[model samples]
Target: MILPIVAYGAQILRAEAKDITPDYPDLKELLESMWETMYYSQGVGIAAPQVNKPIRIFLVDTAQVFERMDDEEKEEYDDDPGIKRVFINAHVQSLDGDEWAYNEGCLSIPKIREDVLRPEEITLSYVDENFEPHTETFSGLTARVIQHEYDHIDGKLFIDYLKPLRRKLLKAKLDDISKGKVSVDYKMTFPK
Candidate 1:
């Protein structure tokens, strides 16, 4: 099922998500729905908050990004191979390396993209869909995607990183999104 993404100004998007236990109701089903929603929305990542669920869970699939890259660029990401994974109760243990700017967007904040600077690498600890614990490091575009989704679970948005003036410039557009005034291909639950 494709869940209606919670749009900007939804209180759920601003609230910190809670961790879910292994026995959480319909865990597998929810993950499946989230993946369907993400793919349907053409998003590389999606967090629980985006779907009006205040849980520390997010999904990432970089295959589409990989598919768009040329041979030379693909070589740098050979190890990733665009694997999809579920992250539950994730925490970024550390962020290292120089910060780089990337154009970032969110399914919740549809049609809005901005250059956001983030660390080049991240060390993250989280439980997988099956509740297995793992700690790993990620770099490049993968890391950037993870960081973006991670912010969602933490009640942060990419636009929050922008300069005050830049954000001010986008106020009207953001307001339009909140009020369901913007056009989006995917279904969204806008704030009242």
Candidate 2:
């Protein structure tokens, strides 16, 4: 089932997520629902926080995009783009390189976008659907998306990385969002 995604100003998005346990009932079903929700929302990634579930779990699938591209196109893409990795109780083992900034957005935050600085690559570990432990290295856009979603589980938002000037300009908008003064428009281009 495709669950309704929690929008900006939802308290769950601000609260840190709890770790998932192996014995949790319906774990498999929950992951399926998450994938459905993400696909229905036309998102490349979806975190538990975005679904109002404060749990350390998220999904990413960019396979379709890469699979359709030719060899030259794939070669032009320096990073791995074919894997759909799911993370449960995941943690970043290390970060590499100097701070790099990218325009970041979130499914929870809707249309808002901000320049957030993060590592160019990250090493992370997590459990798969079968409760099997796994670890992988990620870089480029994949790393950026992972870091952004990972932060959500820690009660962090991309706007938290905004500079003083940017924050000031967005203060009213954010305030309005938090107070329910504004509405969520589905057409808004998010993760800007």
Candidate 3:
């Protein structure tokens, strides 16, 4: 099932998501639906809040990103082999290394992309889809994707990192998105 992504201005998108226990209703089913929705929407990552679910869950798949890179680029990012993972109740233990800028986008804020600066590496601890605990560090593009999704669960948007002037310039577009005035290929639930 492809869930309707909650668009910008949706109350849920601004609310901090709660952690879900292993027994959360239909956990398996919800994850599956999220993945389907993500792929259908051509998104590398999706968070529970994007689907109107206030739970700490997000998925990331970087295979497409890896595939698009040339041989030289792949060599530079050798450690990143298109990781695909589900993070539940995730917490960033630490972030290290110099900050780099990456163009980021979100399913909830469709058609909006901006250069957002973030740390080059991060140490994260989270439970997997099966509720198994894992702590790991990520870098490069993978880390960037994870950080973007992590923000969603924390009630943060990439645009929030932009300069005030840039945000102001995008005000009309943002308002259009909230009112379902923008065109998006994927289904979205705009604010009422």
**Candidate 2 lDDT trough over 10 residues, lowest sum:** 183-192
* Candidate 1 lDDT over residue span 62-132, tens digit each: 87888788889888653356757899999999999999898899999988899999998889999998899
Clashing pairs in 2: 105-191
> Candidate 2 — what's its lDDT?
0.77
User: Model 3, which residues run further than 4 Å from truth?
Assistant: 76-78
Instruction: Pick the TM-score winner.
Output: 3
lDDT by residue (95-188, candidate 3, tens digit) is 9989989888888888889999999888999999989999999998999999999999999999999999999999999999999998889999
Models 1 onward score TM values of 0.96, 0.84, 0.97
TM-score for candidate 2, please give it. Answer: 0.84
**What C-alpha RMSD separates each model from the true structure?**
1.3, 3.9, 1.0
